[model samples]
Target: MNENVVVSADWLAERLDEVTVVDVRESWEYDGIGHVPGAVNVPFDSFRDEEGESESAERSGSDPRDAGTLPGAETWADLMGEAGVSADDTVVAYDDTHGVFAARFLVTAEAYGHTDLHLLDGDYSSWMREHETSGDAPDPDPTTYEVRDPEHSPFVGREEVEAAIDDPDSVLVDTRDDWEFEEGHLPGAVNLDWRELVDDETRGLKPRDELESILDAHDITPDKRVVLYCNTARRISHTYVVLSSLGYENVAFYEGSLTDWESVGGPIETES
Candidate 1:
């Protein structure tokens, strides 16, 4: 499986024994309803900072952005350890609600320079339907995991996003729903809902040819530097993973999405 890409259910089912699967649902969903057999339960919130919020123009250092902040460095490592994840392990993450939260986990992992991470294709709901053996995943043996700044990172800070807005060759995509896009969006952003990248029936990413066709029709070409954002950045990261898998090497995601944009009083536009 390609690291930092989406993995089909078939690809994952065949390699379950070889990789570590992380379920990013909350405690109630995981410990209550159940999860993929042998999957580790890593609630999505673990990666976000509950205390330290991100900076916005309105609050500056005072108000945190709407998106979740990263937890402390060692704290991230411990969370991985609790899931029995080692630095070398090929990890796959999923969530019941689309791949939003799951993608966040992968993005956070990428920030820490974790390699070989994948998002399970289809939402967790479909996976559970087919697998049917949902229950508590065994408590994983603790292991040491390291967090470091990678030589190259996939995140786009507010400053970089602002720069991209002015670069003619760059494409900034707003990955929120149509209603949200109509309500308001960042300046010069093209609206492309996150759902468009995946098949509704299968909840799996569209084939490359199909995806390319759609993107070409929308003027989202691979040649341009791409930046994505949503209200909370989760949807943006999901699209980021899909685009990266499609060989988009120069892509980045704005962690502070529209809400953050609004927070800073960034210029916005709406449909007439």
Candidate 2:
């Protein structure tokens, strides 16, 4: 994983006062279960469009599948502002459910031009095993977070995915289980379960060399444009984070994923 993007629990513990810690798990978990000291709660689901459709869908009057597209820039800015996140903060996000939710937050933040983003290496459980936790929630001073043009689009629509089906330079990855991939997958897509990238014991990312070997074995090298997806885009968000942390420059995800693809009668392949 990219050392710059992933930080160990010990690393975070040392600089806890210098960075903005965000607990992206549900409020119940953040409150009842306890979280890192001084961390602010910004539930993961808050990142998605509440109406279950993106602003683009609203304009076209398209009743697309509810694959949980992201909210508009203004909405994201407001959410960040409310969470006491400023544009200049070096944010460190962590969640209990692996790093999927935290990864989603980081990716969305990157899309909104937040450059100093990082993910805790492991889940909250792993942290709890080694560090102290607290139930107190911090009421941070709110800061104005203005939205700006994205430095890079971290998502791709169906049209770009369709074009990639035949693009020699692009590789489509299905970040689902073997059973799910065998049941049905996008044509020309390869399977790479997101769980494989994380250590089963530590619940943190596998070592860099191991991750590199796995990706190399799958031909998911850093040279190609990698597009990722899962049933609803939730699971694949983890893989998107992994690829980005691995220094894969041209990585993006299909926000609508297979649900939206099937809604539009897109082709699918199943193991015979």
lDDT top scorer: 2
Per-residue C-alpha lDDT of model 1 across residues 89-180, encoded as one tens digit per residue:
89889997678789888888877778788988887866776665567668789999987667676666677888988898898898888898
Question: Per-residue lDDT of 1-272 in model 2, one digit per residue for the tens?
Answer: 23488888998999999999999999999999999999999997788664654333233233222234666677888898998999888999999877988988887777677888888998798779999999999998887997655556667778889898898898899999999999999999999999999998899999999999999898798899898989877788789888878889988678778876877678999962
Question: Model 1, which residues run further than 4 Å from truth?
Answer: 1-4, 50-68, 129-132
Task: Give the TM-score comparing model 2 with the true structure, all chains together.
Answer: 0.91
Per-model lDDT: 0.77, 0.82
Off by over 4 Å in 2: 1-3, 53-68
